[model samples]
Target chain A: MKNSNENKFLSPGHNACAGCGQLSAAQAVMRGLNENIIIANATGCLEVTTTAYPQSAWGLPWIHSLFENAAAVASGILASLKQKGDKKTKVVVQAGDGGTFDIGLGLISGMWERGENILYICYDTEAYSNTGIQASGSTPYGASTTTTPDGSASIGSTQGKKDMLAIALAHGVKYVAQTTTGFPDDITNKVKKALSVEGPSYIQILCPCIPGWKINNDQAVMMGKSAVQTALYPLLEYSDGQLISSSLKKGFQARPAGEYLKNQGRFKHLKDKDISLIEKLAQANIDKYKI
Target chain B: MKNEKVSLITKPNTTLANKTGAWRTAKPMTDLLTCIGCSLCAKICPEGCIVMGEISESAANGKKLKPKNKKLKPKTDYNYCKGCGLCTHECLVKAIKMIKDY
Candidate 1:
């Protein structure tokens, strides 16, 4: 029996914006998975775009719940699979940073605490991209968003990005990694590795949003690379509470944070002083990661 | 029972009926001669409309071209492409151009 669809997972013809970094990264994530998996997706950009009424882009057994309940939903799915004594079918959760870091944090922590064999992927756009670019818990400092608009009297996004990796580690997740849309191969490899590990695993991917970041449609890939090169968000991996590998270890000399900040309209209002302040954040990452 | 309806569940990959290509104001065209066939365009395409196709006489006007890096060239499905120009902008050899769609 032959299926008519050619795409193995997230299919084409979905209504996501052109050059969407999140969707592109999703393709990479899908590339790493086989047919033996079920995905519980949160209510966010990925969900709304793919699963419009009477149409779905997903080519797998996917379930969508409320924004804050994807982790909880996955837990239920895991329980069902356990009851059926099914070991081959993997359970996965997909969420935007808004869901993972803010709305769904409690449910995610509970899922992690139970030590379930689930792979949770967070597409970190840094802001609430689907909700008109509002400030999310993952939103970095000095970046303008709808809620954190930069003005003559103020800088954008007063709060720094929440350290999600530390929080995941604190929960004792077996595998944790971070990558960007720029490195699709790395994203796929990390996903494969995470799935191989037992128990809960977390992979955070920095996905640039076109309108949210005030970037040209074609610039998403470039901006994704720049984010990594600047050390604002470096490619990282942690296994069993130990720093295992990083992009810096692969001989990437960190570029200045200003180079990354200058490209986006979100950071256009930042002066040299403001940029240097942001640089301190990058420096802190470099120091903390021992890169 | 034959007329029973499934509730709250849609068929998989039914979004294929939604031709998002109509939203494009521009379209990407690749120069076969200059293309290195890195397949980055196909890899990065959000629409997943770009597929790497083998270069044959039917594609190259009866002249065989030597492979520079890869043998396959990107063939875009305009019915789904939104003309994001990611291919044109990210082409390593500057082979793709964004032409206004008619």
Candidate 2:
């Protein structure tokens, strides 16, 4: 929401460590918005990392609120802006995995059903990364976290990450999509498209966390690209129940999700058969995205 | 309030598909209190955007080089930033955001 002609994000100083894909994913979304846009960021990695107590990395007009209420506050901002004939300013809400899939679900759904023009971007680092690596609804099956510890027969998260895309579609929002940090250009473009659309828009990005996910800072983007290659995460766009463009799959042969997991410490709990299950799950994701 | 932003393009090459690549900007700011000054951003900056500044060379990753100035101030050059954001994204102090002009 920080707006200059060129540097709309106002990212001067931030404390998010390297390999924190949340920063990049968040910046990508902001870069794509109109310079006049205003943003409401939820409490999580993006909030803690960008807006430190005295200073903020934000160059745009941004407000950080309770994790569960970001969408609602953003919705209110949109209404107020429209009421004043400030129709050109775009309103966006940024949330993390914990807020978007768990605590904030009801509010997000309500925003969708209301068909507010807000563009909700979830920078899903896949857990409650700020507090600690705790499993949230967005956490993928077999991934390790504080809650899903690496122990005997305990292959981290047991269920697939909730299908937020499908859920958004069910809400019948004008637009919904999935993206990853490895695909910055695609993510930026989608953000722009969502902004142009007339109704509520939802896009979730797979933001890999360095410390939380137990991956190297250098390996982050490559891991993200690999997730899509392995079908652990696919690139695609959707609207009103119709099929839209699917970002490049590279169809480079679906590597097992285990391959994607191998580089990260989060999935260290996984064993051979458990890894196989992850492979199956990744395949399932690939199959679903093929449409 | 209708939140009014456009959707990100699904295609890869549209003009709207702005690239967020590697960084080459200058002035690698790390949090002194939090940063051990590991020089990770300096090591990762492909363009060598960072340099030794007020702090000793031993204390920082590199020299106190200036960030290439651009349309935006506080010293930012989007021309060189590349958006790789490798420096701040990996900063031990968590200081960096690829904040530059469009």
Candidate 3:
């Protein structure tokens, strides 16, 4: 389907940055959702920008919950729908990486453990972008942020990104997928696939932040694509406990990780050693996924 | 004065009343002569302010016409466009230009 004009659920007049990858990804997510859907959006860039006081960009039935309670709010909504015998309606919780990997982990786990029928989407911008680009659980290693500034004797963040995908699998979610803004169709297809499953599902989309990543406004899409092509953030999918698909394939000549890092000012501080370290990390993913 | 409770709820679509055009430092001007009428700009616009509309005959006649096919050009709703320039960037023929808003 056409990306534009097909989905009017997420109207476009709000104040997201020009060429905001998250907003583009959100539009793709909307394409997969039907009319009988309700969204519980967590506090983040998406929530703050879309619902600025009296103005709202949401064309669907949506509720803004606290940063850590979107999953819980969705659970409650699902319960109410169940009580009303409304099986046709779907409940979706949309959160940022901070909400999913850190603040809301407990509640998300609780909802998943209860086996609620909900589709949870995490727009992983890699840092707490709304709060001025602070480090979050999903922030990559050696990346500069407000809190993890690269200085003398410092290479930005010291820790690796948290593997939230494994956490979802541990929670026994039936369907889980990871995609980036580079592939809009993949995101839409995965969301549709996740919603088709009977139990809880999860999708994490790598939405490159413009100001946070220190890239030009028009470079978000290109950065997202490079991220996948470099295998730094490979497109991935899992059904039940099995890996159904991964974009990283054997014999596929991977683009140098430096290509992905060089454009963004956030990674400008990286030295040869840091680039190799990131390359090693991507190689490790390739090995693990057998791609 | 009596203490009164205030309701935070406002009517839906109140956002529509807001004319965000004031936020533009640069404005996108579409050059119909260079435009291919591909609608890529309209498709990629983050703000759904761009719409494909019928091209006037006089305006079409002023340009070198591809006589076989009738095409629709995109028009911008400045009331909502924040002048993000996504459309200008996506335009293949360089039809859209971001000029000083004033």
Candidate 4:
């Protein structure tokens, strides 16, 4: 539809779930991008919903290849731009946590090793939402998924979420940041900052899934904010292997982890003791990242 | 490149043809009197259909207001709203409500 406030990058009418946190976070990401850019999207919910057959919601040049090769595709794009002597247009890679943490990790490491000036954004849904909510490397402990369903004997996923920021830092990425869909402005600003830096950068955004997290449509944003407030997934930024900013500052009082866990069906099976264990995890993050 | 060698690339914004409002079971209606012009709804809309618009004279007719301060309000494009109810839930002043679309 014709309107004054049409989103320049991502247009409306894509088939993403209503109030989808990933889509909303992507909206913010688009706001940070200028017209002179190309995006390499990995196979996931963002790629599937936006580019259907002969239709595309993206207003800019966008490409989708495979789940595990978006970084490679972005590298190729950067190489082509370099060969063409086109220094203006920037390259970016967008992938879900499945693609970033599990499938595309090797290729992403290779890209970072070369130190290509590309921004890699990971939409951390914590599970493979497009594949019917299967647990991935980013799935937090005590959260239920299709593969790690909670039952009489099992308490959902057994492992904790991977520290992707630290891994990105280990690769000597120039910029690394973490944000949630709750903070749209923060996501946009961080995207701008990452693009400003002239080397490999990584940004991971916590995007809640309605069906995967088993939350109400409106609860996605609330859950994202609660995740940060509970310090379960704190807002963080790193520069050249040094901590630049974080949410776990001295004055910050973390909300009880239970407030965030009890709101989602994925964590519904967690007991009081299990909740306490999760609390300890958040506490450890607090201690580890204390400023 | 010849036409026969063309790849299957699509045009930008061609997905606009798919009017997603048909998927909505509810409609968000806003009370302008209580709106504080925050535009949170416009920012959080997944469809990117909500926009901030100037309050028209008729829209502000019933409510008494200082003419010196004209406030902007969120206007949703129903053609793509999808009735997610996020705007209604996140409204700062509880001005938006989700009513049955039927």
Candidate 5:
């Protein structure tokens, strides 16, 4: 779709948090999409915040399905469109990490296994922000949430983040990409590329949450940028089972993970050992992704 | 008596009727003197509330600037700005400031 100031699919005026990374990423996603699209949104922050009673932020044809059935709904929409012989119209599934990584995985897998023509976009906010900041499967280690508080006895969530990208790749998806809210253009380009593909595509975005991350609202973009620069969440893309592009460059040394962690209250209670553990995690990502 | 069912669909794009600026606790005030009319604030504004228009002479700080290349200034439609302060933070010259909504 052409990027014009006057042509926006996701017009602002919803109840998204100020400086919300998800909303910004959603805007970028909308920019990448053409007018002939139908979106099946899972029940989450994006769905709830955008579609309050009698108001909606989406300019496109949108539907809010059950939290775990967005992929299924999109698959149905694809089937209907195909039956109608509307080859030009696109089908998209938008969901949060809770819906994508945990609740809706089975249905999403089914959609991919069926080789449906759909684009699934997951906004990874780490935790369930809309539901009082509870921990989700995608929540990173050492981050505190209401369900996984960092007290003297605990260092927040004990488990590491689930590798959803690897799972997507394993699903034989032709197009799979991972980006963060730090890079709006990257998100837009990835969405455009995913939409161009004929079969199932998945793009996961690391959208920083203000309340969930316990960071100031203004720090969402900074935190997103830091998350990438620190090598904790590098931008990556895989096309047809091959690594095609990455955001990391040669001689690109990562900033300390603490630089990304220190600004957030979620990691406030982390001890030096915890910070070192997180640093080790970042290092592992750097080594694995070859950033 | 025949029963009537309520239509599930309402008019599309009716969200424009909802004035969300009332939810803002703080409002952004743009400094026309420092603003270079680069339109970064408008580009970064998630609310799509910032509109670029001709700079007024009173706010021009007596620069005797001719309108070249549509030298514009950002005027926010507070009707939807949520006081995110993103525009303020993203401003290259720090031209935008967040003041009390009152």
Candidate 6:
């Protein structure tokens, strides 16, 4: 779409965390989209920020649904658009990790399985960020949350995040990618590319949340960049059943998952062995990608 | 204006966004992984500040994903940069910048 300031985009007054990665991601998305598209945000941070009753921050035709059913809502949007012959406008589903990785996983999978023509972007901050900093399915192992706090007995989030791109790829969809708030260009470029693609596309973003992870607000962006640079989150894409190119191929220095943990009070109680174990997690990521 | 080397993204209503630059300058960031080799960033650039040339063609996606190391190795036309971080913010992967230098 032609760039124009007059075209209404993200509305004002919606409360999002200052320097919020999701907002940055959302802004990047606006840059990629044509400005005429409608977004269906899940009942997470984005929805809460945009549709607070009388005051809404969204600049487009937006809908907010339950935590786990944004995909269904987007599907309905596509189906309704098709029924009305509204071909010019595209529909987008925006959800958080809680909505996508946890509660909404089944519906999201179903939507992709059906080859729904829409863009579903998951802002995976790795937890249920809006609701009291709880753990979600995507929460990394050993990172503490309200419920998964480090203690004498357990490693926080024992399992690793559900592999989203693989999940999307498994659905046999047209396009899928793993992205992060770390690189704005990478995020926008992918969004633009996905917009151009005709079939269903899933963009899984490794968004960082200050409060949820108990990280310093200033560290949010840096942490995002760290995740990608450290090989903890590799930037890759899959298309037509083939693994394509990767981003930042020069690769990055491996930072400690402890570095990611130290900033947040969540992992404050972690013992040295716990830190070492998390370090192993980081090493495993590097080994898996062979970086 | 003195710090030409840094990024500066103002709040809305001050400058240009992808759709709302009626009275401001908002630049875009390019997320490397998310970029799909579309020339939209270059095309949308009002001042040719974006060197789409840096976009890497990943060995994986033969025709997709642009040049790599854009952040550390970009050749921007700063006179044309306009202090609008539309390119930085527009990036799906969040790679562009309108920030002032530290």
Per-candidate TM-score, first chain only? 0.97, 0.94, 0.98, 0.98, 0.97, 0.90
Predictions' DockQ, in order: 0.51, 0.05, 0.29, 0.58, 0.39, 0.04
**Between candidates 3 and 6, the DockQ winner:** 3
Model 3: CA > 4 A from native? A1-7, B1-5, B8-10, B29-44, B51-59, B62-75, B90-97
lDDT of 5 by residue, A1-291 (tens): 122354357776778888888987887787789988999999999998878777777788999869999999998999899899999999999999999999999999999999898999999999999999999999999989999998889999999999999999888999999998777778889999999998989999999888888787777667878999998999999999787887666777889888899889999998888899999998888777763
Chain B TM-score of every predicted model: 0.87, 0.38, 0.78, 0.85, 0.80, 0.40
RMSD (Cα, Å) of candidate 5? 2.8
TM-score of 3: 0.89
Best by TM-score: 4
| lDDT tens per residue, model 4, B50-83 | 8877777677776666643266677888999999
lDDT (Cα, tens digit) per residue for candidate 6, span A1-291: 122222236533345654466765676666677766888888888777555554555556777768888889889988889999988888888998899887998998889888888899988888888988788888887778888876678766677777777778888877788877766678878888888889899888887786887765445556677777656787877777675756534455676666766767766777788778767766776665542
Error of 6 at A250 (Å): 6.1
- TM-score to true structure, per model: 0.95, 0.74, 0.89, 0.96, 0.92, 0.71
Q: What is the lDDT of residue A77 in candidate 2?
A: 93
Stretches of candidate 4 off by over 4 Å are A1-5, B1-7, B62-64, B67-69
Cα RMSDs, all models: 2.8, 11.7, 3.1, 2.5, 2.8, 11.9
Q: Model 4 chain A — which ten-residue stretch has the worst lDDT?
A: A1-10
- Candidate 1, residue A138: Cα displacement in angstroms equals 0.6
Error of 4 at A195 (Å): 1.0
State in Å the error of residue A193, model 2: 0.7
Segments in model 1 whose C-alpha atoms lie over 4 Å from true places: A1-6, B1-6
Clashing pairs in 1: none
Candidate 1 vs 2: which has more lDDT: 1
User: fnat, candidate 4?
Assistant: 0.69
Give the Å error, residue B8, model 5.
Answer: 2.7
Off by over 4 Å in 6: A1-7, A248-252, B1-102
TM-score of chain A of 3: 0.98
